[model samples]
Target: MNEINNILYITGAGVSEESGIPTFRGKDGFWKIGSKNYTPQEMATRRMYKENPEQFLSWYYKRFAAYRNHGPNKVHHWLANKNLITQNIDGLDGKAGNQNYIAIHGRLDQMTLFHTQGDNVATQQAPWDSVDETSLTESLLEVFKISLSTRKPMKSQSFKPYVLLFDEYYTELYRISEAQQRMIDADKIIFMGTSFSVNITQMALEIAVTQNKPIEVVDPYPVRIPYENTTYHRMKASEYIERAD
Candidate 1:
């Protein structure tokens, strides 16, 4: 347990399945991929957000079923109880009892959208219809939280996916924070469940290795990808949870 303090955890979809979200990439025999399934980049992009906001929101909200069907599980619960950085935004980390953490890609429970640079928004929810204000970044923290806590679509505020989409630059990218930088610069990085599909996030891993840090890659399959200095573990996420106290 003491070793975890030196840890930087980068979790992906696999870590979330225990909470009931389906990842079409992993082979648990649950979700089958089809030609119709939109490439994550296509479905979750700024262009889509503008061209078809409702469709984008629908795909995202339905996938983020944890908002309604499930809660945090042993792994997320365990991470919250610890002091490690994570890459998930399923809100399980919060439910797991951890309040302070960095979401490298973004979060599903928060909302961010394109508004005129200086315009103010009130909340981040799905099927967001509000036009004058449509981003979570523009609102106060208290007001934003209230916007997500309810189910009704408001006449004044809109709620969009809190998760950063394919082509959208993060609000943090313009000015990187210290804690986020530290998490990226850890002595040991542990990756769980995510297939390294996106180039931007993959860049972070590249940065970590370039700095001479060692990485431990954990997944159900041991298939190797590029980049040296990574240790691999072939095991299901649930397998570890089964043994945890």
Candidate 2:
């Protein structure tokens, strides 16, 4: 294989699975373990946050908070120096010292004001440490700036998780424009550990197809794309890195 230049690596949950983070789509994944009254699809949405804040916060805290400290694996370390756009909210790529990568799906360790996208709001570090699961509801309410007495989010005071909810669209908050520009400028696009289910992957693939750029998919069971210059690496992300090295 020739040395590929201007390569943009678009990663997904599969990349973080090696670091003991759940892909959230497997049979035992987080999405499969929804709350008593809601499915994961329903629970992970803006509607849920607005209508049932307690359940939403509780579910998010239980599932995503536990993996907040997972260290990056070899794949993350290898991709650290490369042009990258990861779909993971785990924030492991940043942990691996990749300062320039885009986390298109937002991040678990961050929070923003409860405002719509493209609203030019600022984000801050989430106060996960202040939460106690024993008093999960109240703790989340306090940390997220919700009112305990009314069980409603305080206007302008309440905050939302940095994650891109199910019903939310990509916006400047997630750096969607920069990511799209990266896709357009790349000479080659490599998708690692992704199932090609999300919009970002599809967007990248479309760009690659239209621009006639080489495409690579790395996974244990790679999804085949019908492009002329596409390649498939049927292996784990770490395995692919080792082979490349």
TM-scores of all candidate predictions against the true structure: 0.69, 0.97
Steric overlap count per candidate: 3, 0
Number of the predicted model whose lDDT against the real structure is largest? 2
lDDT of 2 by residue, 1-245 (tens): 87768999999888999899888777778778999999999999998998889999999988898889889999999999999999999999999999999999999999998986578888899999999888889899988988888777754679999999899999999999999999999989999998898899999999988889999999998887878798899999999999999
Candidate number achieving the greatest TM-score relative to the actual structure: 2
**Where does model 1 exceed 4 Å of error?**
1-4, 27-40, 65-67, 83-85, 112-159, 173-180, 223-228, 241-245
User: Can you write out model 1's per-residue Cα lDDT over 1-245, one digit (the tens) per residue?
Assistant: 34544676767778887777676465532234321556555776767655555445555544553254368777787677554545566667777788766665556555644353224544345332332233432233223222434432332344345555667654552223644576465777777777776553476577776787777777887447576888887886667556544
RMSD to native, candidate 2: 1.3
Per-residue lDDT, model 2, residue 226, is 79
Pairs of residues at least 3 apart in sequence or in different chains that clash in candidate 1: 110-162, 125-159, 125-160
Error of 1 at 37 (Å): 9.6
